[model samples]
Target chain A: MTTREIILARLRAALAPAPAPVEAPREYRRDAPVDLDRLVDRLTDYRAHVHRVAEPAVADTVAAILPAGATVVVPPALPPAWLPATVTARSDDDLDHTTIAAADGVITAAAVAIADTGTVILDGSPDQGRRVLSLLPDLHICVIRTAQVVANVPQALSRLTPHRPLTWISGPSATSDIELNRVEGVHGPRTLHLILLP
Target chain B: MSRTFLGMPTTAPKGVGHLRGAEPFPAAARRALSDAQLRRNLGHATATIRAKSGAVVAEVPDWEQLRAAGSAIKADAMARLPELLEQLEQRVTDAGGVVHWAADANEANAIVVDLVRATGSDRVIKVKSMVTQEIGLNEALEAAGIAPVETDLAELIVQLGEDRPSHILVPAIHRNRAEIREIFLRAMPGVDPGLTDEPAVLAAAARRFLRQTFLSTPVAVSGANFAVAETGTLAVVESEGNGRMCLTLPRTLITVMGVEKVVPTWRDLEVFLQLLPRASTGERMNPYTSMWTGVSPGDGPQEFHLVLLDNGRSAVLADEVGRQALHCIRCSACLNVCPVYERTGGHAYGSVYPGPIGAVLSPQLTGVADNASLPYASSLCGACYDACPVKINIPELLVHLRDQAPHPRGESAAMAAAAYAMDHPALYAAAQRATRLSRLTGRRGRGLPPPLSGWTADRDLPEPPAQTFRQWWASR
Candidate 1:
């Protein structure tokens, strides 16, 4: 059989619908044109910022949140002003695992966020940086542009390919291993903070 | 590698599907529920990941649509896999990377062994790779008297403890920090004897332990998350730098990639890069995502080899009901959310491929006629189906297997008994009423009866509904 025919047959067998499609169409638990304001309001558990502002003030916002004496992991190619002077930060290339593990909070720019799912996208770009810095630190503060938010996975796919490397972040690295009881901050960051800069 | 490579043992056979998926999930689950410790670890891990995944996924206005696109793209690719693979091989070869087509597990292992031997290297540091694990590359090398050092921290701990991976993303998810410290003490050649269970301390211990391997190892073996046919580029995404070290420092790099990992173009990578980490480790981006095309002149590894193994994949494709299994990315997100996997752990799946993906993938790879036990490994509750990003109907496939497979006589007997009860409404009523009596034909208590004990063995059956729906309907 032709390869296309074989693939369709396999899918047909896997589905085995009597007439109409057995697999349900994609679902959304949220109302259409979902509440972005409400979503961003509650997205992060940590103290956060949800202001409608320009891209340039990211440094000031991050600076306000970072406490004194907190070590920050800045991606090697980050915009210098994205971070405040109060935080002692190292470049992504120079920082080791030890420095990341000891740091109080991590801050980085995001690739995109899906409002429907309350998720963020990270590619290995200077803007998004590497995965470890966001993961190892106890707290994470992410900066996002409103325009980057897409409505669905399909639209997002149109923007991506197997070009380089990409990473997707939802909330934080957590486990529910302790007695079916959830304990965050075991392996990855315990607290997640997101900033929506319009 | 600049240094010579070692070979696999002569006559080392690829165990292949000689063995079925011998999972101990049911038994392991029963024991894990009570161990408080294991449950605690899993519960905490899954809950945090779930919430995080849910949140980040929410940020995407079209997350579900994206999942659909991702699933559809993979489905579309699988139909044209052969052509894509040939295209991938041509591109890699044209770009100067040696492409080895391995027909089966043994052939893949032997080819890798010979490749390493050709390099004249006896020892190689390895990045955490599921393909090599599936092929038993380490064991094959060890039998040939080579030590393949695991550089990924979790993998190193697992190797040291001689333990199986419990979770896909966190291979050592079963062990607590205290247990990890113990493993380090017993396994490390000369690790800090008084290390604490603190994450910092453990990170330090692993860092010191791996530093030498990173600087000294001449060869590294890896698995690619995505192979871009357009650019002949192979990519490895990770939260730790060890994967980068393996991709670089080594003189020769060998990648074991499943034939299904190829994507048509580089631009298509955006969808997966966005989906993978959030699905696997709940990260926005992996710590290190290194991409290289074939062999480079003065940069990174001077020599490169890509071994594409079919193993049982072609066999899987031949079966109409099972071929969708190839769309899997091995992200382990399904494993994390699956109640079955939560309790049974990865080792219970009985193979390098674990979780729901493994359940479907293994049975198909090995064939339903052989690994029949795997399909029955689930409750068919459809949790796995819900968790799968590719929309693979794992539960439905499981039932299909059940129908196609010759059920063990025990299962057939059990199913027959169940069918009998359902067929005869009066008999079902009587049995349901009778089961409320806890006595095994001995006591006068209301609980569970003897004949139906197996169904309620690990679970508490609903105290036979106080009133049958039929009786209520009759009265009405």
Candidate 2:
């Protein structure tokens, strides 16, 4: 046998046999009753923003965190929030470096979302604008739907195809190694707010 | 041979002082068995890094493509490394910079200490370079009466704390704000009397402390993120401006980088530019990416010394399957995602390099003969491989190293027996049948013999089923 074949044979013997083929690798499960407070704390540790968005609850959350007439970013395909129509959002259209950097924040919907790892997938297209907008912004308010969330990375990957561009977000951007020291806001958002819907 | 990676003192005893009777990884892990503080620190730090990396990485549309590009670029760099090194040597020589080649860590250290001593400087400011750490540069410098002051904020914390780094990206990740405050209060030469653990407060204190070193220090040391063969440029990326200070301000700058750190051209940087920043700090772009080509006139440092240290990298490079490790961007994304690193922290690994990348990379560099137990330091979880942007199959490499490495004593022979048993069908079947007795005791199975007892010490081996799967298959 060739070297590749020999190696593959050894690897095949090493690994447990592949499980009987399943129709789909995706295994959807209902959200278990996670302690919201614990979830918030855990997500916050990762620089995630947590706010309840049950109709009346969301507007209050947004208003509480952001001041009036504050520039908030939203995708063209975003769910409507009660912000005044006049409060202009920088859409993901004609998004050059200059325009994106100038904006206060840019929000986008997730692709294959993971709840176990608490990640949201954003594939940079029109809505996700080059991945720089969400990263550079001082504050990012991510919109996550219940159905969008999967249990684990495997499930998330199964839902995602290789064709589309995909970005998986779990928490805020931070670094700790300058002193074995943890420093957030090195290159990404110092603040991360996640909008969760039931 | 040049010992470029292992920076030990000539004055020190030739033999390794401790770890003679040190049990394998599992036995050493017993010391940390009750250390809750270490666990808490590691767990919190790794989880946080993972979350942040997940967040920004999710926003990118072409992240996979970018990863592929990064992997391809690194692969390209590795495949033609010898040619590139020769090219880089010619280029660096053509430029004003002096290039030194060392085959191992000892040669690298001797060359550097001699050069620094020749310059008659007792102190040198340092940029946070893993190569220097791997070579034990600080300790080596201290032995030679040269103080290598770390200028990076995080690096400053680790240096002052007199502590080893835990996470690659966040070396002092074990330190909380309150702990940092305590470290500063004790170590800083003229630390603020009443310092809080506030990140900004700590940062200000470090900045104040290092500002003098940055301005006055005549000699500087650093490791490169990428070395360009085309222009002989050394690239370093950092969040704080300290790395910039180390790279510039000083009259004499010495960069000790691994042979693997070289990239072929300037444009190849585009792939790593995206791959490294996001994978490391979880950023779109590193805050400060400073690149210097040889020595510039009337610009930064005039005298540039590039020490190309082989250490044991040639052995690693020789292995076709294992050479992919050289492709590491040093992003530390793997460590963030690794459960083992999250529990043990970097210190338990007993090396400058830690975590999954460190587990493979350090042993490869330092020679597994010296630190034989390190390869098994991890649980072979593929979390690191999944997280690696360049797709380094780190777990596979770890197992491969453990198999190939000679034991410091006769420990490797024991593993050989285990490997034999696993590879042999009858032995595996017999072992499975022997394990069948534990079925009677269920999950609380005990009395499994010496090495088997080691397995039961930490975890209950899965009780054999009423019928072995083989039995069922045979009957069917």
Candidate 3:
């Protein structure tokens, strides 16, 4: 018999006196009022820069955040209007790792944002592009629409499609490995700028 | 055949993996307790995490309800593990991914080695995975002429120091900042000569050291924090961007997961995702969590292989009362809260899994006889049970395993004699009166003689009261 068969057999035999099925309790809060203040508070707690702006001002915000003469990588379907006029915007259609690494920053749209956790979820959507686009660059400028912001994780998960690849960024990369001290910026984008748009 | 005689044996097969420590828990704990430096590191780290975890857990009004839901979800998954695993395999295979089954660590290791060799990549970057550490996967890769690079900062420290991980969340919890700086200066290539012990500086040094490797490594090995059986989605929760670097940049991604890690549905993640971050690292949410289903074209790794590893997990599942240990999410909350763990540290437990959870789990995985001393390693403080996100009753499991552990003949005899004496009032009285003889030895009995000396070796033997309780009661 194959190892799979053997393992299955063992499991089946071991569970001969099968345990009774248990129903998981879903008593935890599933939804709450979306509090933008709470979201900003959480984002700020994680050391992420949060900017609340009008939808049309996204370009200006991006431009202000980036250094002068900076080149930013954006997903292929990212709104052209959102691209800063001051900085060079490169699409990630045929971007290589070296180029992505060398880029000053990355800009993308989030699929959903969790207010309570300060998390932005990307579903490999047209605007968010691939996972690597946000990972390789030192700076990540994620734009989240007010309509896409949810109160908690459950609401965010329900809004997301599981089959697509997902990256949940709570903050710029951080670690608590040294003496359990939280240090921000390791291997991932050191600077995370969240542009909340209405 | 008699019905009673036909019962099945549920214990795990012997000589399988790294579950057992070379010496018993007491001996190893003795060595660890002597290391004052280790004690200080563990004390400081655990205290800090406990405070952090406590504060975050307090922020949620429904934390208990969440814990209950998390526990039930895991129990439901385990009760129907076979079905969930089969469903997961079918879904993963349908999504342009390959799934392999390994009954033991050696088989799992061989499968990973061959897959790396087939990719023709001699170096594979790795995420910090407890399961991989449990199986000693890095050593297996090295034996096959493959170098495994650990990307997690704590794991990197452990690897460079050629040290065993002492804590789950922070592997190098035994080392402080100065020690980490020393390790980096000695081992890290191209490190700045003026590096300081500041955490940010050390982290930047690691980022600089691994940046080129992350960009170039063709293959990566990871362990899943949770795998959704329904959607074939795997989630890896990490702090640093290294997880993303390894998961995204590598051409071939291989994930080794314990079969028990499978959850019934994607929706079940809400409970765990909330409970885990609060209980671990005391954060509302960790910095990064990556979830992928099989492979994504023009996205992350196009080639994906999921290895479902048993390695005595089925054996752990066989025991009715003992199986709850499988419900652990590896949060390390129990370790941080455990007093015994704070004192002796993870090395004393002698398994990749340490602290209260390990005390119960290691014995069951390797069988009671192999890891007998581990069951007694705990003080049954019930702190781990309270701290567990999945509500695993670790103290209960410890007491249960202790019942199954072998006891020395002399101890058993002594217990039998005590029981008999207690059964007879006259004998009990005589025994109590005879205990007054111990007072002759002084206020504190220095040590007992012969077979009983083992008990008093590490513990204090107080002097017997001058008057027996029975005599005092009669006089009153």
Index of the highest-DockQ prediction: 3
> For residues B1-476, could you state the per-residue lDDT of candidate 3 as single tens digits?
43322233234444544577778888998899999999998899889989989998999999999999999999999999989999999999999899999877888899999999999999999999999888888988998899999999999999999988988889999999999999999999899999999999999999999999998889999999999999999999999989998899999999999989999999999999999998999999999999999988888898999999887787788888888999999999999999899999988888888899888888887778888899899888899999999999998898899999998899799899999999999999999989878855444555457677766666677777788888999999
For candidate 1, lDDT tens digit of each residue in B134-210?
77889889878778998777788789999876766677887777788899889898887888876656766776677
Between candidates 2 and 3, which one is better according to TM-score?
3
The clash count of every prediction, one per candidate, is: 77, 34, 0
Model 1 chain A poorest 10 in a row by lDDT? A174-183
> For every model shown, what is its TM-score relative to the native structure?
0.68, 0.66, 0.97
Superposed by TM-score, candidate 3 places the C-alpha of residue A17 at a distance from the truth, in angstroms, of 0.4
- DockQ each candidate and list the results: 0.08, 0.04, 0.68
lDDT for each of the candidates? 0.66, 0.66, 0.90
- In model 1, what lDDT does residue B73 have? 67
- Model 2 per-residue lDDT tens digits across residues B392-451: 999899999888776434345666877999999999899778876665554655755665
Instruction: Give the winner by TM-score.
Output: 3
Ranking by DockQ: 3, 1, 2
lDDT of 3 by residue, A72-178 (tens): 88999999999877889899877999999999999999999999999999988889998989998899999999999999998988999999999999988999999
| Model 3 superposed RMSD (Cα) | 2.4
Candidate 2 displacement at residue B381 in angstroms = 2.6
Please identify which of the two predictions, 1 or 2, would achieve the higher DockQ against the true structure. Answer: 1
Question: Which lDDT tens digits does candidate 1 get at residues A33-146?
Answer: 534665464344322345455668777777777777778877777778777878888777646556766778877787766653356666556766655566556677777777
| Backbone clashes in model 3, listed as residue pairs | none
